[model samples]
Target chain A: MGRTADYTNERCSVAATLEVVGDPWTLLILRDAFAGVKRFEQWQDRLGVARNVLAARLKTLVSHGVMETRRYSERPPRHEYWLTEKGLALSPVLLTMAEWGDRHVYGRDKSPVLFRHKTCGCAFHPVLACEACGQVVDRRDIERAGPQDLTAPTVGEALDAVKIAAE
Target chain B: MGRTADYTNERCSVAATLEVVGDPWTLLILRDAFAGVKRFEQWQDRLGVARNVLAARLKTLVSHGVMETRRYSERPPRHEYWLTEKGLALSPVLLTMAEWGDRHVYGRDKSPVLFRHKTCGCAFHPVLACEACGQVVDRRDIERAGPQDLTAPTVGEALDAVKIAAE
Candidate 1:
């Protein structure tokens, strides 16, 4: 191993996010979620993941508001987990990372969970662009346009959502 | 106790990248590279990392052509490492991850690195936008203007880069 990896003691935002979603299972969970895997048993079956690990990841995501648990069956006290807005917002991040992987790591002919634009009816890259100008943009070009109101106690980050709407 | 995360063996690209760069030392090394930390000793001092691990990560990145090693000081037979175009291309990925960490893990006021747009002089979100419309784009709206000469093994993807680009 090149470097000894440690995240438990770090107080960085990426680490914080990673603390919840950095593992193979969590992302795969989200991947399945995006691919329409909602039920816990379905996730367990599709991913071939341990039940304990799946339960824990779902619990953590729910605790963090990345996912929500809704009662689907009253008799069995069964609940269905769904992506919250916060969870759904991660689509772009996942797509971008997937694209990056597809380009550099995966086989050239690997099949990806294809995404099609609902509005324009086109298949596109997971890119960042200016809505007003239609040109590609980076982190340096956008500004925080919404209020910051975090519910949790992050090391340094606020819990409020920053609107991505470009000015 | 939290969840168990081992990204190195995962099949996803983020996991694959993390297997290479997600570790603290590798990230710090890349951080130093972007920060102009080229010398081996400099990385050693700045990151408080083991010399062997540092050497290994560097070698690995160089092998992948993410960074290139060049002889700079002939007097001592010394060499320095610089990022390749592929490495430079990772700027957005790094920034996006860092931004996520800063926003979710660390608080806004405590962000380690601050990015400002040179042209507009404003803080921006490392967002993904559409190349055609120049608007903040999603995955669905983009078609792959894929690689021109893909010689790597093909998996099962149906469309080629040319076809994706033509769309």
Candidate 2:
């Protein structure tokens, strides 16, 4: 709380993303959304969240363009919350979180739910892979580059990189 | 917070995981950990988090076994926080979250930081692949199985599945 509360402008992507979905309840809402729960009452009942909290989270999501609303019925003005393409792209974030939980928290075969690949029909886990080389990313395999790189820089090099990237 | 603040026992893995690292500040600390900031003062300086909050989070992480303490200085018995194997396993959760922010918030090629796969030396993005079949996983390719399946379950099937899995 000491720093400025506005984190969306941070250069750190995780910080930026967490600004949007770091709240445990917000992430739960997104989990339900992926499960095809769209109606307000459904999320309320499923998450057992306070009405005000759910409404506020939904509003934030819509404002951020992660979700869009469509009227399911005009007669009573019922609306359904749906994931926008940007929200759908968060599939990996959520899935990998779940994957970590399954492995480290639930202990593999003890997972309460299973993700079965529909095409392959095998209960699966999310593997992080390098898009450039098609290699499964091991923790030992990654290094940071650019402004945050742990090593190396010329004068103004870091600032210039950020400015260029911003542009 | 109504249901239970003790989320570590939740049946959901993401929920359990969130119980440990869901706090924005906690996640930020872990981010710094991955960036190789180990000592107490380093995290404090980098994050600007209040001493009490930072101390509480480090204690929580150590208690949960996600991190461990190693004595790095004998003068005052100073210790450095380090990620345990279980904690290192969370690399994907943080990295994927950053990847999402890079794509959705910053736009492609605008990331302030880039992850270079040291093995290949290419700035890379994370791709979710199904560990079972070795194919890249698509949203369209995954469906829930067991208790959380969207449809088709016998009376006791779901409950029984959870029990068996929890075993």
- The digit string of per-residue lDDT tens for model 1 on B32-90 reads 68767788999887657678888988997876567889999899799999987657656
Question: Share of real interface contacts recovered by each model?
Answer: 0.29, 0.73
Q: What CAPRI-style quality would you assign to candidate 2?
A: acceptable
The Cα local distance difference test for each model comes to 0.58, 0.76
Docking quality band of candidate 1, CAPRI definitions: acceptable
TM-score of chain A of 2: 0.82
DockQ of 2: 0.46
The candidate that wins on DockQ is: 2
> C-alpha displacement of A12 in model 2, angstroms?
0.2
Cα lDDT of model 2 by residue, B39-115, tens digit: 99998887777898889889988866789999988997889999999788888899888888777776664667888
The number of the candidate with the highest lDDT is 2
Q: State the lDDT of candidate 2 residue by residue for A1-167, as single tens digits.
A: 11323344345778877877876588888988998899999988877778987898899888777999999899978999999998999999888888876766656745677888998889878888888888887878888765663342321343344346546
DockQ of each: 0.25, 0.46
